[model samples]
Target: MTTATVPAPSTRADAPSASSAYRLSFGHLLRSEWIKLTTLRSTWWSIGLVALVSIGLSLLMATSLASFAGDVPPMPVVEANRQAVQVVVFSTVLTQLLAMILGTITVTGEYSTGMIRSTLTAAPGRVAALFAKAIVLAVTMFVSSVVVFTAAALVSGPILPTGPLDLGYPDSSVLPVLGAALYLALIAVMGVGVGFIIRNGPGALAAGIGLVFVAPILVMFFPRVESFQWIHDAAGYLPSNAGQSLFMGSPMTGITLEPAPALVTVLAWTAVVIAGGIAVLKTRDA
Candidate 1:
């Protein structure tokens, strides 16, 4: 009786792994998000755009610098070179747009494709999913920004030598250059939050562009009126403008918020938008 044959270990098809049958791990969620981000065509476009923008803007500014060289007196070659190169480094508006696109796609694309449903099914923890997305978006944007900025510097370096713009100087404007990249990444995260909250491409795109361009123009235009002048001053403190100060070594004298305060303001905006996204994600059926 004791010798009765023990049934061979039955291998059941579609059997769940012990861990996956129970719960999703944060690490697994992170890997999934990374895969989703890298696999998308939009991600490649966003990254390519960043590099192109950085280089293109630098070249344009370099041309402007060449035109202005006639008006200014000549100085020591290295210092002059540093100043010229700074122009290229400072011209990174395109990089900002790239970050925004990348960020928006982090959530909005999934919603559009219905992958979000699968994502939720895999990891029922809404916060976990959001956290994974934010992390992936931030890291990708940060790396892309750095690469693009470095490429811009290299491309612009040779053109500036005769015009007093030296390339690759260690001491000058490193902080601002690095800050620009970080700021771009932060902006991308802000975009992600906005995209998630809106959950539609056209609406998110419109609102994003409006905030970046239209609002600032309106604020500037109304600065003459007393009630709206406050709007103008406040506009400089908005994420797009204020965060950009990180790229400028000196503060705009009329701007009310200092560098620290401005960055904090941007951070606060990100927190609000992300919180809203989290709320929607938690309550929605997906």
Candidate 2:
């Protein structure tokens, strides 16, 4: 019998490995998050809702503005165009709730379904996972919001005069037009951070809504109690108020913050939320 020359397992250099190990990386985490996001029907519904709200309200606003004949004081064409852009951007307020819900669900949904255990098991780095999810959420929301605003601009173009509203893409006013979309993306990431901290859908949703909607109301309401000047000024720095300042328009006499300060405040708020999420993401249970 040919001494079963099953030559000892070849450990020679350049030998083809029998097995391979794959390490999870940021790209893999991001791809996984994207897959999870796209597979959900809510993502499509939210995007559709954003489009419907932005376009519907934008057209309605433009039509209404155009109909204002002799009753209102005549305004300059520049002012009219500014108001139109403001109205178009305002439509995003309603759609932002959808973005927030999407962001919250990105992480909280996994926890609700007990899928987080598998996710953590695969990655073993909660912060990396959360960061990836945040990136996905922010990018999608940004693109969706940009599309919504683009649709709004197209609809508003036909109704408004031939000034800034006519093919406004090349105008200087485009800065705030694009800035509003970027702001929505930031809001979405803020939702992701909150979701990671809460780890529950309903709770995270409520928290997000309260922060953008209710918190400003409460903060503004405080001044009515004692008519405190500082309290009233402080309201301008609230999250929603800051976001509103980001839109291109003349700030209402006293209610809105300066755009520069508001931008800083909004960035600070997002940073705080992300830091909180990072601190607890690794320490908390799935």
Best by TM-score: 2
> Model 2: per-residue lDDT, tens digit, 69-186?
4466756665665676786787756766877788888778888899989888988867888888889888888887878887788777677543235344434356677778888888
In order, what lDDT does every prediction score? Answer: 0.71, 0.76
Question: Candidate 2 clashing pairs?
Answer: none
How many clashes does the backbone of model 1 have?
Answer: 4
Instruction: Write candidate 1's Cα lDDT for 144-260 as tens digits.
Output: 777877778777766653553343564444655666777887878878887888889878877776665456556644546666666666677667777665456433322655557
Candidate 1 overall lDDT versus native: 0.71
> For model 2, where is the 10-residue window of minimal lDDT?
163-172
lDDT, residue 281, candidate 1: 84
Clash count, one per candidate: 4, 0
Q: What is the TM-score (0 to 1) of candidate 2?
A: 0.85
Model 2 accuracy (lDDT, Cα): 0.76
